[model samples]
Target: MTIALRDAREQLRDRFLFWATLALVVASTASLVTGAIALHSDAATYAAARDQLLALGKDAAAIAAPEFYPLKLMRGMIEQVEIMGAVIALVAGYRAAAAERGRQTLALILTRPLPHWAYRLAKIIGGMGLAAVSLGIVIIATAILLPVVSGIGLGTDDALRLALTWAAGVFYLTVLFTLGFGLSLWARSPASGLIAAFALWILVVLVAPQIGDTMDPDNQVAGGVFAQLSVPKAEQDRIKAGFAGYETFRNGIEVASVTKHFERFTFAILGIKDTYTGAPVDKVLAEKRGDLLFLFLFSLGLGGLVLLRPINPDRLTKES
Candidate 1:
């Protein structure tokens, strides 16, 4: 508790965390505004359709009003988090490890009455708490800006879904934080961790997803290649079924990315994915079980490494 609070205050003051949080807020506000415009358009269309049906004398009971999930307005916010959120966590992790090494703070902490592993464990817990704070501010902004921009109040169901997505975001950031922190500790030089972290980020967060998307025969063209060519869904599936090996390889690349799983889980929860739109929360969670497992295992693995990796102060002191 002591360490976690101190981590929050200290990281917020650091230039990296301060600037990252500010930039994320600015970008997410814009995404939510754009989402609002889309929601209002959908609402207007629903109203027009309802009126048209009434004029046709359709039974009132037959004309069920469309369900509007305003939480769909946060798709852009999710993507922004997918990108910038990793940076925030990575920087926090790097600074936590690198700064302490430069100051020999870990060595000094080890000399205290506390057990050898206590400070390390506390620092990691502190790091996670720090990530939660950074993402919490964005989620709060999302709650505020969503209704104001779209003129549609978020329903209790949608609010609960949004909260679920927020929790997933915090977990996703925790994984990245541990990865960065662990790398910093393991690297011989302080700079290698930051470089390697960004390299993996570029690969897993950015490149892998693109490769998967572009590899899909349906996604090659604007507005979807299959749609543009007037391809039927059944035919598309049948056609791709013959190339199962190719599909498997492409999916394998995407599955390696923690960001992809985070996006998939959150998208299904928030109805950003078309198939999941209007799906019940329980059903969506059940369907996305694989993604949830990946996220959980990713966090558990990274956290285990950070806690268990051999820590040598001699290596830190030697890294001129």
Candidate 2:
């Protein structure tokens, strides 16, 4: 344990970690500040729009909902944070392992009295610890800074959501690191390992999501562009029955209300909508947690393989 702690401390003291941590802090602070400013500006615009709509005798309740504006602004800000966080994770993860290989220090480290697993474990824990601390700082800064700038305070639920999102960030970092570490072991040089890891990250993050969406059964193309575009009579009747008592919105205002007859019916029971665009907040949170867990397990599996591989760090010559 003492040795592991020493290793972690040494890792943290490296210049790479120092600069990476600084970069993360600056990036996160800037993003939060910009988001706060944008939200405040948006709030002003919304107020002006609301006044104009009111002068025209239009219902402004939907557009002027205080909760709606904050939610939209906050969600957008969170998404930006998520994107930056992922990039930080990927860079940190790849460098964590690749640096040792680049320096040809892996052989020396493996030759130490410390067991191979300890070194690998230390790398994983130390790398993740640094990322978590960096992310936490950003989260704490945002919590304090946002309310001051945007007049929007984060609640306990929001904090929990942010934490969960950060955990997911950690999982992604771990996956990238493990993949990079494995490639470092397999490749002759650090450059090749980094390239391979980054390419894989791009494929997983970008292509995988698109593949998932494409394979979704609900996402389908129907009839030609201009063939009266009507549902089958039976389907039309079913749809009408489902929407019999639902409110409909056009633009930002609710213009029509269906009868109250379906009030007792569950959304599922009535099949009113296949899925709501904005899901129940709790479900979304749970899904994020699940994604984090999946990534963590996958990374762990990869790391395990790296641990079990024979320690032949001297296989690559100086020329190679």
Candidate 3:
């Protein structure tokens, strides 16, 4: 417990970790601000268009009120985190193992009275604790900002959704952290560990998603690729249907990319997906059960692997 606490405090004081976390918060907050402005602008435009139409004796029934789902505004923040926040996890993970080796502290720490398994467990818990704290900041900021931005207080459902997203974000970041920690454990130096970690990050978060998007044109862009194509819905649907075995291919890609799984689950929970909007929260969750489950297993399995790996100071030092 002491080791865990000490390690967490050390991580908290790390300048790189602190600044990375701050950047994450700033990016997410910016997304919230931008989303708020966009929402207000949209509302204003709809009102103006409606007034003009009504004054011209157009049918009032034709105008629809844009349903302001406050939590949906967090879409940008979630994506930003998936992209930029992964780097934070990589840094934390790399530091967890690499810093100890670089400073030659691992040899002394290993010489302590503590059992090897216990020491390793403590470090893993400490790393996860730091990740939770960083994600907690995101959740708190989102909670505080949501009500102010949308002019609507969080309802029971909205609060639940936010909670779920927070949970997902924690799990997502922890997975990356564990991956980084594992890479550091295997590498000879901090630089090698960081490089390996970022390489994995690029492959998982960037390459996989881009390949998936390329394979399925409809999923290529934000707000659906068809939205920007000026294509009719029927034509889009027809084009989407024209592809053979695309659904299976797309699902396979999404399953491979942790980012996709996290994004899909969070988007469903927050009603960011068009099909999920106005749907019952329970139904959306039910639909996304596979994604949520896969993400949990993937994270926990990798974390467990890290926990089980032997932390030999001699091997780490020799490699360095």
Candidate 1, 107-214: lDDT as tens digits: 787667876456667778888787778888998898888888777787778877877887788789998888788788778776798889989989989999989977
Candidate 2: RMSD to truth: 11.3
Q: What is the C-alpha RMSD of each candidate to the true structure, in Å?
A: 3.1, 11.3, 4.3
Clashing pairs in 2: none
Which structure is stronger by TM-score: 1 or 3?
1
Which candidate do you rate higher for lDDT, 2 or 3?
3
State how far residue 312 of model 1 sits from its true place (Å).
Answer: 1.1
Residues 128-226 of candidate 3 have per-residue lDDT tens digits of 788788888977887787667655567888878878888888888888988887888766666787898898889989998778777776665876777
The 10 consecutive residues of candidate 2 with the worst lDDT sum are: 255-264
Off by over 4 Å in 2: 2-4, 14-18, 21-35, 41-65, 68-91, 98-105, 210-289, 316-320
Could you say which candidate leads in lDDT? 1
- Candidate 2 shows a clash count of 0
Backbone clashes in model 1, listed as residue pairs: none
Model 3 regions lying over 4 Å from their true place: 41-66, 220-246, 318-320
**Candidate 1 error regions (>4 Å):** 41-67, 113-116, 229-233, 318-320
